[model samples]
Structures are given as structure tokens and as C-alpha cells.
Target: MAQQKPTKVMKLYNRVTRLPYGNKIFSLMVSRMAPYFGTIRPLITELRPHYCECLIKKRNAVHNHIKTVHVIAICNGLEMAMGVMAEASIPSHLRWIPKGMSLDYTAKAGSDIRCVAEVKPEQWVEGDLLVPVTAYDDNDVVVVEGHIKLWISAKPPR
Candidate 1:
């Protein structure tokens, strides 16, 4: 058997951040690699195969008509967290893509938001899976709840 290599996300996190700059490096890397993530400017607070967490500041760019974090911005944070989680957790031989998403805006987000995504190893199979993602406000109240459907498959021969 061939030696397994680290996932792209793991390599990027280790190489770019070097565990020194902390969330700053992660925010820069994610924004650079994925322009959409830049729009929301999320700072990753935690990243691992089983879990991923990110923070989105309450900036004018992401503000809503009511002077609160926009609903779409909250969704963006959720997706970013889920994307990182999937990249880090999925099996090396398998590939995954966001198939769809469902979200519920549960409360008003008046301050910085924290988004988290998590998945169990058993959930990784060649099929459709729904990953749970949640976003909370500074008060620790859930502001958003959602599930991102990911399509998993085997990578074709090079």
C-alpha cells in the first residue's frame, strides 16, 4: 500500500499558519484561496478533522438593514466552517463537494458571530451526507442553524 499524504487543508494550515500567527494566518489563507470566503472575512478559531470553528466580525460590509450581521453573511461563515471541516476530515481517496444547503435564522446577530461545523468519521461514505453547521452570537445564543449536503466520491486515476 502507498503511504497516505496529508489533506490539502491540513497541509495549507500547517505550512501557512505554522501555528504561530494563529487565526490571522488562517483568515488570510482561506480568503486568498477562496475569494468568496474573503467577502465575509472569517477568522478560524479552531480547525481539525472532526470540527472547525470560525469567527466573523460585525463589520459594515456584513451588516444588515437593521445594523446587524446580514443573514447571507452568517450563511457564508457557516459554509466556510463546513468547507474546512470537510477538507480536513474526508478520506484521502475520496473527494467531496457542496451539493446544497438549508438554513434557519434563529435569532438576531448584533455582534461578532462564531460558526462551527462538525462530523463523525462514520459519516464519510460514498454518498450524500448532511453536515450540521451552527453560528452563534457574542452572547452565545444560536443565531443560525443549517446543514450542508456534501456529495462524496472516489478520485479518478490520474
Candidate 2:
């Protein structure tokens, strides 16, 4: 069998990640593509098949009334990581969309947070794929843990 071509987003990530401030540039591009992601001002630190990592700074804009990072803001970061990872890792013949997310707030998000999403290689087949996601504060404390359920299916013929 022939090797499948990478998705457009994966190709763009590969090209941009080689330049200085490449990850920042890629993050900006992604934010522009999906303006809602711009709200968190996420910086994608890493991207590869089956995994993605993003950073969200603890700025006033993302803070809650009590002065800690808002849960929704962390959710946005988690969703971004999951979306990108699925785009990069899905089989060429398959496509995916998030169905829902189930998360638990484990601790206060008191500082900058790192969000991560991962999928096992064998989990890429068609059906509901639950991508595991987690967020940690600067002190490496788990602030949130969850899974985003994604519906994967074969792409329709042209």
C-alpha cells in the first residue's frame, strides 16, 4: 500500500515549525482560522501524530472573578489541542469532529496552563474516538482532566 499524504493542516504545521518562532506563527494562523481559539491566545508548543500540546498564559482576560484562570478558558485550550491532534493524526480516508467533552475540575488554575491531547495509534479507526486531554498549571498540578469524544468516519467521495 502507498503512504498516505498528510492533511493540509499537518503539511502547514510541518512547513512553519521549521522557521524561527514557527510555533507561534502556526498558533496565530490557527487562531485566525478559528477565531474562537483566539480568545485564549494559545501558543501551540508541540504537534505530531497522536499528540498536541498548547500553552495558555494566565492573563487578566482569561481570569475568573476569584482571580484564577477560568475553567472555560482551559476548556478552550483543551479543545484546540484535541482538534489539531485529530487533524494531524487521522487516516487520510477519515475525518473527525468533536461530539462532546466530559471534564472534571481537579484544582485551581492559578498560573499559566499547559493543555495536552493524545490518541493511541490504534484508536484512529472509524467510530467514536475518545481523545484524552489534561491541563496542568505552572506548578505541574493537574487542573483539569477529561476526554473529548470525536466522531470519525470515512470521507465522502468527490
Question: Using TM-score as the measure, which candidate wins?
Answer: 2
- lDDT computed for candidate 1: 0.88
RMSD of 1: 2.4
Top lDDT model: 2
Worst-scoring 10-residue span by lDDT in model 2: 1-10
When superposed on Cα atoms, how far off is each prediction in RMSD?
A: 2.4, 1.5
Candidate 2 whole-model C-alpha lDDT, 0 to 1: 0.94
Instruction: Find the number of clashing residue pairs for candidate 1.
Output: 0
lDDT score of residue 109 within candidate 2:
96
Each model's lDDT comes to 0.88, 0.94
lDDT, model 1, position 140: 94
